[model samples]
Target chain A: MSESRNVSIRVPVLARVEGEGALDLVIEQGDIKELRLRIFEPPRFFEKFLEGRHYAEVPDFVARICGICPVAYQVTAAQALETLFEIDIGPWARAMRRVFYCGEWIQSHSLHIHLLAAPDFFGCGNAIELAQIAPEEVRRGLRLQALGNELMELFGARSVHPVGVRVGGFHAAPPPERIHAMREKLAAALPEAEALVRWTAGIALPPDAQEFVSVALRHPVDYAIEHGEIAASDGLLIEAAAYPEHFVEHHEPHSTALFSSYQGRPYLVGPLARLNLNRDRLPDDVQALLAETGFALPSGNVFQSMLARAVEILLALREALRLLADYHAPASPWVDATPRAGVAVGGTEAPRGLLWHRYEIDTDGLVRNARIVPPTAQNQARIEADLRLSLLNFGLDHADDALRLHCEKVIRNYDPCISCATHFLRLNVSR
Target chain B: MSANASVRPRVAVHKFSSCDGCQLAFLNLGEDLLTLASRVDLVHFAEAGPLDADAEVDVAFVEGSVSTPEDLERIQRIRARSRVLVAIGACAVSGGIQGLRNGADSASWVARIYDHPEAIASLEHSTPIATHVAVDFELWGCPVTGTQVLGVVNALLLGVSPRDNADKVCTECKRQGYPCVLVARGIPCMGPVTRAGCGALCPGLGRDCYGCFGPAESANTDALSAQFARLGLDTQAIARRFQSINSQAPMFRQAADKARAAGNE
Candidate 1:
């Protein structure tokens, strides 16, 4: 009979991240062990609560699912219901959607970069501490983040959980002057954002590489922020419509979020995956910024995700500028969307990663069924896998430091938005 | 509040059950953030970076609702650590949109999302931070605006009383010279009763206010209810409109209660 050894780890509070979560790893006999990334955040039951609510109420209801990427929820929910109603918002409306989405990416990615990711590079507990050491860098990062929020406010009417988004389009398009004002800010922000990319790329990254099943949207003409077909590094190509058929979510005992597997395998998404898969789609300036930072495609060092986010920030700024330059106010801010009985799915690349919404609507346009799969939920399994692989190499005696850094790295890789993944909020860790 | 105080005030942002939007709002201050950071000690902000070794806080900006026992205890600790604790956003101020479940069974809500309900432990309802600890101020919104957040920070820095108006959204609408969507299109709106911080956003976009900003100070519920009734909306629909988004807020809750009571009568 073989003797067994027990290994356990508990993180009292997970730091430098949004929402709340804890990790518990139980190792027996040194070979491997039980790892639980317990998502004990209380269930708000957004899908259940969404039942019988009018289709128009979806943007507000779903937007509550994530504070970080409320626009993502609003866009995906609006898109799903709009599809059910067969409402085709014109190019101008679509451009507005792109603009709104760009705000979310800027806000969310910048949060990840300065507040969440940079602390690891500087050996600080959080961004606030990093500010003490390098105040200018932190300030530049915050300004860039604010610029994103400005866009959200200009287009969506509020930075978080905007009320202007509707099924067909915005409640009202911004005035030309407001768009121009935002353009001026983006112009100022572009250089700072590019500098951030260069600065972040120079950070010493962890050398471990994994053959990632990177997943992201691929648009033919530009870097895919709002609209595109879904593509993965493993040669799998599918339209957004085929998402349900290609990927499935499984309920795991350790998490409230459903772990998603693409064709029965764990996959990676978000800025790193997007940058690697769609580098060709990025603008020349953004591509050049990537080159200047020495960032290359298919780089599996998860730490470079911060750099990838910076690269995307550059792309978002350029895209925002381009959209502003060609801005044309829609004849009507929104089209009348009459809900019909149907089941529909809407998929979009949220700042964090792929956000999906599926809904069944009745003839009266009330939601009969609602299922939202956020990027964090999809990344849960991969996060645990990273923790398991990373920590297994490091022994239990150094568990606290190893586990903390390991957990932070794993979380940074996914850029998990726990708020979007759970309906209610709480973070619990039980070993 | 001394202008020439020797030590700069320490500000820390905390999270419970939230979207991290309120903290993001602080980050949204941009270049102003550098000035703010230099002016004060940013002690602990998890969404921005790492947690401080010490838990002491001078002014704590707390986001999210108290949705668990741990949150309840953490709020108490934060209050003990801070001289001023400001509850930011709908979640922290009024239990947020998730508070829609306050009237429902939390166990059932859990079962709806999870396969094994027994594995999870949670409170029956999501409640605001003030329910657990004394809050010096509350910023209302589904997600509070960056400008308002900066205003609070600036007020605290300047040692001046933070002036947050509790006017109705209608005031902003009238100021902006926008047409009334509810009166013109018969769309149900909460603008007359909703708080004013959002600058009449939905109405500006040609839509009725959905009241993400909670209710105005001393809003006339009876007037709005009668007006909604005059608009030919049913009692149940009126109740739902009042109960949504800001349902847990006092003024909105009172209005919803009045509507329900009126229906019962």
Candidate 2:
């Protein structure tokens, strides 16, 4: 056992994630020598592409960033421009936006749980193999995912890169009849969402407690899906406008994504982070369901992220049902907002985590400058930090395949949207 | 046909430089997605956890555009390994929204977005996969619908050539009985020149189409641009309508150039 072993491991392409990346790890003398989560997803230069475009085009334009969470980009951009132009958007549209976002959460989380992450815990190569063993669970996950997509299409024309959101509000309202049909579907899925929580909680998750700061948007009276002030587990609370003062994204040589740090420290931002900071904000029934699982709030173990995603699905389903029970078509789906010259900033909770957007609009209604900080970019440093700790905990002396699988498991737990992150790995290990 | 062959036809899904939306069209198929595994050997779809990039296959459905040197090399390798390569979405057919960077100073944009632009590696212009490799077919859309994708797969399974439609979006819009936004509301719509695939989604939603599907066959871009001008759009706006997601398409590129030159007049 005292003998030293040297090996080089290269995961040329990290699979089952949102976008393309590879992982590189180097071990020497049975000790960790070098570990780098190389994110080579080609930079699309989205912020630069936003310059000189009209404010009206941003919602649809930004939706191209990530297919998995297109609603996040659209909603955050609309919120920024609407906040800048001083448009109210009214209560009806406000409540509908939350329901729209809930659809994204349900679909994205369900896709991750069944298609991406669940297979890892079961020692299956892919969901297809997992399906052979657990057909009912896989089918249930797909049903929930389809239902979520349907909710999105109710307002959006389609789920992937949906095109319904505009600056002031939506382009068109769903007729009351359509809303009625959707309400029935949401009510019917309640029992299924509850079962998802119980099923995920019952899965055996690995045990590794590590220290990290959790960052998310926190609303005063709600779970804060679409709007909120920026809050962190370290007691840092600030208006979305003040986010730049605390958070600084720096360029790294290996990644196209800018590695974001909160006060020069790697922090967490995702389902686990959101639940950790806002567990009390859940409704009474959801709180009771979560309590039944016996899973403690503010969990430090990253493997518990699966449970958090499942719990949030139930929370989103209930939230959507409550908002849509009294649905009515508005006289005007959107209002015209006169363009103004000023800096616009807004933050919203994407399924992955907090997504922030900033824009400078001119009196001519053109975007003068733009910047977007997606969740995966914020979690880059945190993911790298976790890889080092989790690998060492799992024992570096293990086989390369075992170590590589462990690395992918940890990364996928964050549901890193590399497609969104170029705005956010190949694994190579040398010993 | 491989349908009757002893070996199941192996299929691979490849990614390049764009959003994951087009490939997501496959996963978003939901129930059909599970059944798809039973029909073919999905040997190399990275997002779904199978990662054999070099696996030779009967069909390869590629998403995104070739935007970097790495993308340039990978697409060729995919074309070599694939028997029938189908380019899906605007990015693979034209150059996607990132193609907006084409004909501009890409280095400047990189500098604007990053602190040290020297570290970033990308091509001067994002180009379609067809620019580098021969594409057997093209499914044009910002993101192709699940039905369109399933249709192609089913055709391949039946040992027949998949069909391509080159009709304009206006045809689909008229067929759906949606009021014409251009004539009735004076909204500048791209339906007259944009390809038909999205089933007139924007027009059905009471908004104008933005030409996400690129140019249809023999699209009259000059007429569309002239119509846009009559709708009170300026030369700049007229140019931008053709220059959005499908800016890299030859017809749209020419329209954008002509409109921009007219602004000088």
Candidate 3:
């Protein structure tokens, strides 16, 4: 007969993580029993409400899904609509999209690194607490974050739900003077970003390398931030159009957000996955910085995601600098786009991972059906798996500490945005 | 208290019924965060860090709107815990995009969105935080700008009041020298009544203002509604303009109600 005991780990409030979520683990006689990452974030039925809205309103509407990465939603929605219409947004527009996305990367990655991930490395509850211990590091992280915000504000008009992003292109192209003013600050920020990358790389990652099906966009040239074909480390190459063919989302009873899988398997996305699959595609400067920091490709240690985020910051700084230096304002900010009645799919790399949006539009451009798969929803299963593995090795006597650390590690691995997860904690021990 | 002790104020970022975007703004601070952290202790931010729920705080940045019984209770608790509680974003200052259901039949909205409405529990109307608790200050936007967020933080830390100009978007549009879309192109623009902080974003984009920044102080919503009607906008269309992202905001709400009433007449 197996001895069984119920262990409930409640985190009154999960620290150093975005939004709220709680972990409930039931272990009986050391044999793994039940693990549930309960996501209690009230369901905001975006898909339901999307029906009957105009296609032109999608980018603006879906952008509200996540405040941190609204551009990802806006860009992906625009791309999908453009594809459906067979509209070509010229090179300048595409380049501008890339530039705009780089701003998102800088902003999102810096937020994840300094505020969300740093406290774990230093054993602090949050960044505010960490400030007392490491003020300079926090300051540097904020400055880098600020520069990213500045970039977004320059191009998008507002960082949160940017006004400039439209289906065809921006409402207005930034004037030369605004672009010029940002150049010097961006150039100055490059080294600070490089320093941050090194600092992140130096942190001691938790000892483990579980095999993960790393998924990200792979571009033939340049790092994939905005748009590209979906590629996995396990030799799966597919077009963005084929995403639905291979991947599936299941409605789990515990979460408002659906859990996703690839061919019945959990896959990893986000910075680490991108770094692993497209390391060579990175700009030479970023590649060299990674090499100098000894950041190996396909780093399976999820904790190193923070490091990967920092590296992306470096890449963003370099790219922003280059884009600014070679800046030529487009004559027209947008192309005329007329919506056609059809079903469309759009995929773009959100700050955390690949964000996909699909919409079915009527002849009048009214949305008939909408399906959005956020990065956090896709990452939920992998997080549970990691938590299971991490806990398998933990001693039961240290259950509380072990469970807490393991949960934090799992959360960190995916850089899970519980708020984005459709997304907190309390401890209950039953003997 | 020592001079330095008085100088370095404690800061707390709180969440209500929101997407956590406004609080994410703090994390989005990145490198500047280190400097800001040194200036103030971020005491209780559930999204950014783990802190005791009941911890006393100096300055609270509250995000989201009051949408449920829990939200009402939580906001009250937060108000009691903090010395100064500043509501951030549209959800806090005015009900956000989700507030569009206000003045409509809540039961119909619930039926339209949920497969099992009985499984869920929520208030009939989504309201701003100030409806439940006294808000010391408010920063408006769907998701507020990082600059405005930083401005408030810096001002609070320095013991000075944050400056939020209660002007309409028309001021910014005039300053930017953009041609009037309403007059030139016959678009139904809300620039005359919408708040200024978003820098006339929609107008800059060659679109009429959708009023994401909410209505300005003492906004002439009545005149704007009349102008929109004169521009060939039907009552339903005019109602929709006021019924968008900042639907529950007083100025916009009243205008939308009037438009709906006109439609019935």
Estimate the overall C-alpha local distance difference test score of candidate 3. 0.78
Q: DockQ values for all predictions?
A: 0.50, 0.58, 0.43
Give me the candidate number with maximum DockQ.
2
| Every candidate's lDDT | 0.78, 0.89, 0.78
Candidate 3 segments exceeding 4 Å error: A1-7, A129-133, A394-399, A423-431, B1-11, B28-41, B101-124, B145-164, B175-178, B201-207, B229-236, B257-265
Task: Indicate the worst ten consecutive residues by lDDT in candidate 2 chain A.
Answer: A422-431
In candidate 2, stretches whose alpha carbon ends up further than 4 angstroms from where it belongs are A1-3, A424-431, B1-6
TM-score of chain B of 2: 0.96
Q: What's every prediction's RMSD, in angstroms?
A: 4.3, 3.6, 5.1
Share of native interface contacts recovered by each model: 0.70, 0.75, 0.58
- lDDT by residue (tens digit), candidate 3, B1-265: 2235455777777775567777766666655555666677666677766476677788888888777666778888888988888889988888787776555566654444444456445677778888888888899887787688889888876779989978999999999998899889888888888888877878887788878888898888888889988998788778878877787887888898899899999
Can you write out model 2's per-residue Cα lDDT over A1-431, one digit (the tens) per residue?
34288867888889999997788888889887888888888888787778889899999899999889999999999999999999999998999999999999999999999999999989998888899998889888999999889889988989998889999999999999998998899899999988989999999877888999999999999998998899999899999999988988888888888888998999999999999999999998888888899889898899999999999999998899999987888999988888899999999999999999988899999998888899999999999999999988889888888889899999999999998999521111134
Instruction: State every prediction's TM-score relative to the real structure.
Output: 0.90, 0.97, 0.89
When candidate 3 is compared with the true two-chain complex, its DockQ is: 0.43
Output per-candidate TM-scores for chain A, rounded to 2 decimals. Answer: 0.93, 0.97, 0.94
Off by over 4 Å in 1: A1-9, A25-34, A132-135, A288-293, A392-403, A424-431, B1-6, B50-56, B147-162, B257-265
